[model samples]
Target: MEVKIMEGGPNDPACPLMVDSSQVTQISEGDERDVVQSLVEIIERIGSYGDYRRTQRKECFNLVRRMKLLAPLLEEVGEMERPLPEEAIACFCKLKKAFMSAKKLLRTCHDGSKIYLALESESVAGRFHSVNEKLNFALDDMPYELLGISDEVKEQVELMCLQLRRSKRRTDTQDIELAMDTMVVFSKKDDRNADSAILERLANKLELHTVPELRAESIVVRKLIKERSGQNSETTQQIIDLLNKFKKIAGIEENQGYGIDNVFLPKSLEKSPSLLIPNDFLCPITLEIMTDPVIIATGQTYERSSIQKWLESGHRTCPKTRLTLSHLSLAPNYALRNLISLWCEKYNVELPKKENTSLGSEGSSEHKEEISAVVRDLSSHLEAQRAAVIKIRLLSKENPDNRVLIAREGAIPHLIGLLSYPESKIQENAVTSLLNLSLDEGNKRLIAKAEAIPAIIEVLRRGSMEARENSAAALFSLSTVDENKVTIGSLNGIPPLVDLLREGTIRGKKDAATALFNLSLNQANKLRAVKTGAIPPLLQLLQDKNLGMVDEALSILSLLAMIPEGHGVIGQQSFIQTLVELIKEGTPKNKECAVALLLDLGLTNSFHILAALQFGVYEHLIELVQSGNNRAQRKASSLLQHMSKCEQVP
Candidate 1:
């Protein structure tokens, strides 16, 4: 239809101009002279029907009702004397009612559908469906004349018809998009007849005939709702009234323990979308997600790792309220450990421990039957020879290469799911599973696709020391992929890793060092770390009391210093001092790391070489070369030869 663009009145709320209905009906009936002109007017003024219907709901409904009531009255007057004016008014009223009602019903269905979802009860679901059926029936009653107004309107109508027909003719992907478009149309304001007809048609197409209320839109909603918090306002009230039933379900509640206050977000981490875990809810240890939810004897749940990490970090007061969390009466519920154990027992192909007896009670026939059933189930699915680890070990003795490092890919997703459980053991298992799975690129891609990176990164920040350690290893493997590197950078992995290195346990320190070592392999990542002021913490690692950790730290630093640009960023006072200290007091491994770092730095500039010579690096290296373990002696020889070459080149 030709839509006319008309100027809005000064008082109009920046809306499109609306066309008068009488002129349009007159043009539609039999007159072709003003049809194009009237169509242009309507098209020009076609303010989004969706927006107008939303703000003017009550006004629109009242207008439509008056027009419907006046239709017969005007027609009767037209039969009497001088009825042209009355006839015009009657036609105008009928046309207004048709278009206005269509828009109003569309809005009602959209909002009502959202409420129906929160109801969730079967009886209430039936009631909502009944209302839906009525709406659909009403839509079907709309006059086909409205759609046939002009060729332009005809085009839109025909398109809708073709889509509806195509959807029925085949099981193609286009049907999904068409279904989605139908939802959008239903969301708009439409007259009762149009609204009900679309609903009925969509219901049939979607096999929603039983209860048409659950249109395609509701299906999408149900998929998004992971868990039911049970407490919903609108639909819950409607359903309770209909079914006369009351029930309680978990909803958003304050997370006790860590003192961080809540904030709002588009989606929630919890099942209830309303709950907001504060942005600043840093775990005290790794300063990330609370690895375990701790329930004290007093019946309260707090983030376990967060509270512990805070205490270990020497934060006497809570970050939120500044209350002394350490003194708060509390104990670890071992929630994580228990959950992890259960999952491992059920799904783990490789049992961490051996069972000494039958899985069930002895002697009773029932017990024997159950045990036999369990064994049979295991044998049918899992390889019988490998179902039991003891059996696998016997086979491995004869065939060495047959042993596999991982049990299954689901192991990671399963472990990752455990992170949602309120247990540390589950989190630990998840971290271990991720670490073990990272042994291959295929597994890494799968984990990445599952959106495990962000969750794993979050866990590392909030998980237990062991969790944090394992997470670092997993992230290190993930960083090898370019996409994961960007993900790691986005989640602010540098500061957390630096914090872990500075304050973590021996294992945490080692993992953090290794993670950073892997991270340094990427120039962009190394630059990001350097830019984030991580050089000091990383440099401090060169002097780690643990030889293995020192070696790993020095190795990453050596790699970073190898590039001319990398040397400019990493070759600073902090790095030089740490290297000098390692040269003076480090073990053989530490010495090798320091030497590797120096060579990379000197390759860019002789400045690091001259500094090393001044710091007695040459003497330590010569002594090691002259006498020591073969590995240490070889490293010492390697360092001296490089230094001698540097001198000769100058």
Candidate 2:
């Protein structure tokens, strides 16, 4: 069979190629000659320099490069002198589509500059790259027996595809080199003295150059000193003298200037005899180290007590930055507090503990009495109970210690009882208080043991949005305990959570997703969640632009995918493409979850392997295998291997 390129002007009626019904019908009638000739003509047209010169030069270059590689494989099929199989005919149709799309894109480019610009556009480049990959696969992935091609022709096509891949890799390498060259030029012009100084300090602190030699000498000196001490004091002194002489001879400095003396010595022993504190670690109002640091809306940290006093005095501006306070809420600076504590521990200094208002100075009895007073007020008439609930919520918000105190005062029972009240506001406040109190593990157990799950579930199902949000939050906190997971799941918790996920506001959706995430940790709950229609809402949540929500949604879906029935349901949705997108564009945690979900689906059903490939997951998984973290790499590798086995089975 042979094909000839059609010669015609750009304005000719049939200027561009077309794959019509008659051509397919001809191939189906066992007319191998017509099919092969048509394919050859298309290949010739793709490679002709005269035809390419009339279109965009750059687009034509790429299209020709791809078509040139594919031409030989198609020609090999033509040389087989047999009718095209159904699969081969399908492959040809895809090739024709690629050809037509590329031609149309090229024809739209008006001039040389437009051609260059269009080729440089990422979207255009990506589309062309995808087309090329598809063509490569169409030729390389066909089964030889189905195509009636001899082994020699199959080997030739495979080798040509392999060479094309190597060429593509070289192009990628060149691109990386260009990027690195640009970055190097910018880096050389940038100021980086501070970064260099920090690196130098880190090197000195680690003793990267001197520690090994010091360790070697210290071992010998310690042994000699120990052996001589038993003989006599004089001999021990002589041994120490010998060690000092050896140290001098070896040019070992007595102090390596680690600053340990300054760090370890008490303030009384220091030469300056004053305590030193980092400026960032002290509150501006008192000029004292912050014990309970909190950040205001202006992004300045202050000791909570000092800031409270300032706010109470009607100062509505930050002391350091002098910015107006937009809101009165203070978020705890936990990371800063941790750093301060670590600094104190390194220098053997005691950190002063900050006391909460709810705790007494003396002991547990005084604390118990204070908590009892609050709870008593909460159990009173409506106004007083509301005030007490607000007070307890505020106290619980201050610190975990207050929460422990409130829980010990039997506040869980009272809070749960308030959930059944007629007033929605009171129910919301009660649940909010419970949410805060449940942060303590002990309180979680106590709340669950007090049969608070039923009331929380009731609030979740029937209360206002705020109440439902808080109830879900409390359930999430409680479900952190393994036993409480079963308790919540058994009390018909899955359906309400799904409802919240489906119809709630953004915040409500996040809270519901979080609760479902925790509940899905239990295997029984995962199965129950599937039966309760959890996957559809979870899939909806997966599209959220919030990374946290997407992460939580993917996590719950991954767990649900472990169930066989759940796998079938998830696979039914057009979710594989979304999962693949996440793999390419999501955060590290999101990618990890996405990869796990895909791997689970692939393992559960062999048919899913083909779906994964159709969604272009292989490239992402291969990239993960090369560059992802340990767990992601492991799962991606396993999935790839599984897909490979599925392909080989037939």
Candidate 3:
């Protein structure tokens, strides 16, 4: 089957083909005839330049250059016509691959001087310019519409065009303008007037011949002022007003004398002492004047509502001091509350009514009896047990005292028993109740003593999504006890937890990672987790966008990287690269973890030391040494010293 390239029509037999017809037919099947025919025409057009390589080498070289540019566009066209015939797709792929191979082979066949000689002979440079113009005109006329293209493919093509435009050299001012025009066009096409407006402003600013850095800063400041002006915050509005007044008083023009460094400082801009509220009168949590003030054990006072909400959410530290509270107790700071009230009165501001600071602290004995009744009903009929579990869970969430009371009623054993029940709902509520109860330090021990680790592991393995998450949370709380960590690992709990890390919901993943993190603290448990194939999922969790999970995941990996087997598993180039990236771009804690992990890996092998250097870890370490916290700075300094010694050896 000979497929000849016809100049006019398929029946025009007088036309000459560039390659042997047999070669064209061998490249494609019958279904691809039309697409193959179109491609062959393009190839023939490109091959015509070969005839002139000897007498007109420059023209031929220019033709080849034009074909090089068109090759990407041709590939893109083929991509847009998907659901395309397999033969056509195959033909395109083969053509692209073969063309690149042939070009490479041709280049390798000649020395650089000989290639230059051929290109420069026969006035080729002048002739090539003519050929280039013709090729550009032909490309301009070529029809590559978006008619049959999918939206995704269209966007991809547009992105390709955008990248090509961006990669153009900007040494020429014309190129910069063209780039700006390209951005404006793209922004308009996306129906984003804000983006287009930004581009237009940049172009107009460029015309002023301002320094790029100054112009960029000016634009940023203007945008900030505009955004702040629109916000409803009083502080933001005040800042905007102050800026405007400063500009007016200093006779500063927005376009002319605007640089962040050149701003005039006025004495009046400093906050006056009269405007300051006494620090002790402000709640540390809300940073506002205290109303219904309550004092924690750390001696820091917070608004009652704020402090209660913090404690209810399971935080156990003073917001201001970060000292662990001796208990979740809040006593009314009557003196501070009265001072705030007097201050408000003197300032002619209306003081808000005091919040109800009590959370049933003095409930009647009847209420206590009711809670005890619910705890005892756990052994009754199934419906009664369900209601009782729900009531206990509610009570436990209300106050720390309630949690202690529920724990004293011997609910831990019943909750552990209900975890293995047939109904998923019962298991979920039971696990929820246990999670709440375990928050109490005393109950954590009792739950651990009851050997509830196995039941929680069961829920983690087979419960519903919510149930699994709660079970993982319960495990996390229980593992806070050193004994439970050992027990959970010994009960084959590591593998299921690792499985949850791999397949659980976002909340479940966080809980499982945290649980594994706690368990990994035990040396034996770290080995067990790694033996259960926890490293890969842990590494995968490091890639998560959730900062909490990433932090926990990194902490676990840091611990695992200590042992010989753990070091060997984590010292892979890919893992090292991920850590390097995190060090450069992740949150502060993540940066700390990454630096620590890299330090561990570097200790295991000189190869890791070299790998870290390749990944630009030295600069990050130097930065950390200068500015990071004590732990980060210490580890980074040690690693840097070690790396420096390695560098000195040669």
Tell me, by lDDT, which candidate is best: 2
TM-score for all predictions?
0.35, 0.47, 0.46
Residue 87 in model 2: shift from native, Å? 52
In model 3, where is the ten-residue run with the lowest total lDDT?
Answer: 169-178
Clashing pairs in 3: 58-124
When 1 and 3 are scored with lDDT, the better candidate is 3
lDDT for each residue of candidate 1 in 226-263, tens digit (9 for 90 to 100): 23344444443343221111100001122333211121
- In candidate 3, what are the lDDT values of residues 92-206, reduced to their tens digit? 4334333433343233222112212222222233333333333333333233453253456545535533433332211111222222223233323233212222222233333
> How does residue 262 of candidate 2 score in lDDT?
31
Candidate 2 structure quality by residue, lDDT tens digits, 171-244: 21112212211222222323222112112222222221232332333444444445455565553443343333
Better of 1 and 2 by TM-score: 2
- lDDT ranking, high to low: 2, 3, 1
Weakest lDDT window of 10 consecutive positions for candidate 2: 172-181
Error of 1 at 420 (Å): 4.7
